[model samples]
Target: MMRFAVLGSGSGGNAAVVECGGLRLMIDAGLSAKQLSARLQSVGIDPKSLDGILLTHEHGDHVRGLKVFLKQNPIPVYTTPATARVVRETGIDGGTWKFFEAGQAFTLGGISVETFAIQHDAVDPVGFVLGDQSRRLGFLSDAGFVTRSMTERLRGLAGLFVEANYDEGLLEADTKRPWSIKQRISSRHGHLSNTQVTELIREISHPALGRVVLGHLSSDCNTPDIILNRLRACLGELGHGHVGLHCAGQHEPSDWFDF
Candidate 1:
């Protein structure tokens, strides 16, 4: 069985674990090492047991804890050269780092991983499709728009983790944020809106897709109800209403999703 747990998600931080057979991979380490250890323990995962860490980008919210975590664990970190250089510039060190180009496929611990570039305000952002013979898992977040290649690669997955960052109306109505910040949030290199998530879900809907986990929600601009309602409507229209739906929270690890 292949299973995953979102350790945390949001603007504050993001991380997740994907496990199959005896291999365990941490998708990102965004929180402090202490906080990350506690979250992993909450899910009965030992931090010392992690096999590797795969980074998506160089944004602080996605890679803040990476150096600290690597210092303690000394595990291999896989990412693009651009992101690795950014990490090195941050003055944190101690890990075996491996570089991979976007759109390349590689194998780690018998599982196949395919990487694809994503549009984001970061150096060389990418998403992943991981598979182990029978089941496939697609993970994409921090992307401004869903590209044609992303949709094509994500089809026919057993599970998916995609970002539903905000509701456009809510974001636009929020008076707390400055216009510049608001513009950035709604920009082509920012985050995905709820409507965009719905379109992506509809595009990737298939009978074999068992579950969809939404993450990276904006605390002020989005709510679980708003995102879920929109996604539910789209899934119903696409005849995929039976698929399970889940939301990854910022404060705690989500329940394990098994495939």
Candidate 2:
């Protein structure tokens, strides 16, 4: 059996826990150490019990809490060499480093993890497809665009935790961010728009896909209602309305999902 939960997700921070075969792994430590521990316990997960941390990139919203968190619960931190070097330079040098080349498969506590490069502005960003004997889950967040290879790797998963960062119409209509920032966000190396992610879901949807939790939403530009309505409709059109659709938030954790 495999289970997971998104502790919180948004522009402020992003974090999640995945457990299988009696081993627990944290996907990121973007929240403050205090909050991370509290939230973990809130979900019945003891902070110190994590087997390791899998890092996607070195962006602040994805790694700010890592330094303090590891100080309290030291464990192996896995990532690409470039990502590790960039994160270490930022003074988050507490945990033991474990390196994996992109597009390779590695094993952690009997779980097989397939890593693929992601198109994001951060250095050496990546996504993962983790699987055991009977289940697989894909984690793909903070990506600008989807690739053919990514879709191929993520197909037929039991669950997916992906980013639906912004809506094109809302982003263009918002005046808070400067034009430059907007351009960057919609660029090939920033974050995925709602349309982009929805298309990704369309391509990867299969009989075995049981759940999808949307993460890393733009606070100013995206809302749960909008994305959920869009995704729910898309899933219905694909004859996948039975698939569970969830949204993770910045201030609280999502319900645990088991597969």
Candidate 3:
């Protein structure tokens, strides 16, 4: 059996946990140490019992709490060499480092995790597909666009956690960001818009895919209702209306999704 929970998700922070075969692993520790510990407890997991932490990139929103959290718990941190270098430059060196290259497959405890490159501004950003024989879970956030390799690697997932960062119309109408920032946001190496996320979901969805949790939303430019409606409609059009859809928010943890 595979069960997971998104502790929180958005530009403010991002984190999630995956449990399978008695092994518990945290995908990121972007929340404060206190929130991370409390959210883990909320999900009935002890922070100290975590087998490891897998990092997708070196961005602050994905790794802000790693140093302090690992200092208290002392778990191993896994990521690519390039990403580790960038994170180390930020003075975060509390956990033991386990480096793996992009497009590599590795085993931690009983789960098999496969990594692939993703389009993001950060150095060596990657997405993960973890599973055993029974079920697979795909995690992809901070992605600018979906790559061919990503689509191929993320197939056959029981659950998918992906980014839907912004809605094009809302982003364009927003008054806060200037033209340059808006350009950066909609760039190829920035973040995935709602339309792009919907396209990605349509390309990789399968009948066995049970749940889709959208994350990394723009607090200022995106609304849950908007993206949820778009995703629901897309799935329905594809004859996959049975798929479960949930949007993860920054301020609170989401309910555990079991497969």
Candidate 4:
């Protein structure tokens, strides 16, 4: 069986755990090792039992705590050449770095992970698709748009952590965030809005999808209801049913899922 859980999600920090059998992969290390350890503990995971860390990018809310994690834990860290170099230059400890080219498949802790490019502002930003025996999970939260290639690579996911960072209408009409900042969030290289994500879900909606965790939400621009409503409306059209929709908070980890 494969299981996964988000330690936390949002602009402040983001981390998630994916475990199969005795192998567990920490999807990101945005928080300090201490904070990450505590979050894992709350989810019944031992910090010392971590197998490795897989980074999506070098954003502060995604790779900020990598240095502390590597220095204190002595676990391996995996990322693309661009991400790994930036992390090291930014004072992240990557002495045990293993490079993974986007589109390449790698095996860690008895699970196979494949990386795919995501259209973000960072150099070579990517998301992961992890597979065990008969199960697969996709972890992607910071892409501006989804491509046909991305869709092809993401087929048959048991769980998904796609982004619904903001609601376009609320963000455009009500939010008081500066115009420049607003433009950035609405840009093609920025975060995905609820409508955009809803559209993507509709396009990529698959029956095998078990859980849909709407993560990396903006505290200022989005709410649970906004994301949930859009999700329900979109999936409902495709006749998708009973897929668990979860909203992860800044400090609160989500409930565990065993698939």
Report lDDT per candidate: 0.91, 0.92, 0.93, 0.84
Using all chains and alpha carbons, the TM-scores for the candidates as numbered come to 0.98, 0.98, 0.98, 0.96
| After superposition, candidate 2 runs with Cα above 4 Å error | none
Which of the predicted structures, 3 or 4, would earn the higher lDDT when compared with the native?
A: 3
Better of 1 and 2 by lDDT: 2
Off by over 4 Å in 3: none
Mark the regions of model 4 whose C-alpha exceeds 4 Å error after superposition: none
In the range 1-259, model 1's lDDT, one tens digit per residue, is: 8999999999999999999867899998888888888999999999999999999998899888988788888999999999899988998778999989988999997789999999989989999999889999999989988889889999989999999998999999999999999888888889999988888889888888899999999999999999898888888988888889998999999999999
Tens-place lDDT per residue, model 2, 45-132, is 9998999999999999889899999999999999999999999999876889999988889998789999999999998999999989
* Per-residue C-alpha lDDT of model 4 across residues 38-96, encoded as one tens digit per residue: 89999998887888889998899997777777776788888899888877887664448
Least accurate stretch of 10 residues (summed lDDT) in model 2? 86-95
By the TM-score metric, which is better: model 1 or model 4?
A: 1
The best-first sequence of candidates by lDDT reads: 3, 2, 1, 4
- What lDDT does candidate 4 reach at residue 254? 86
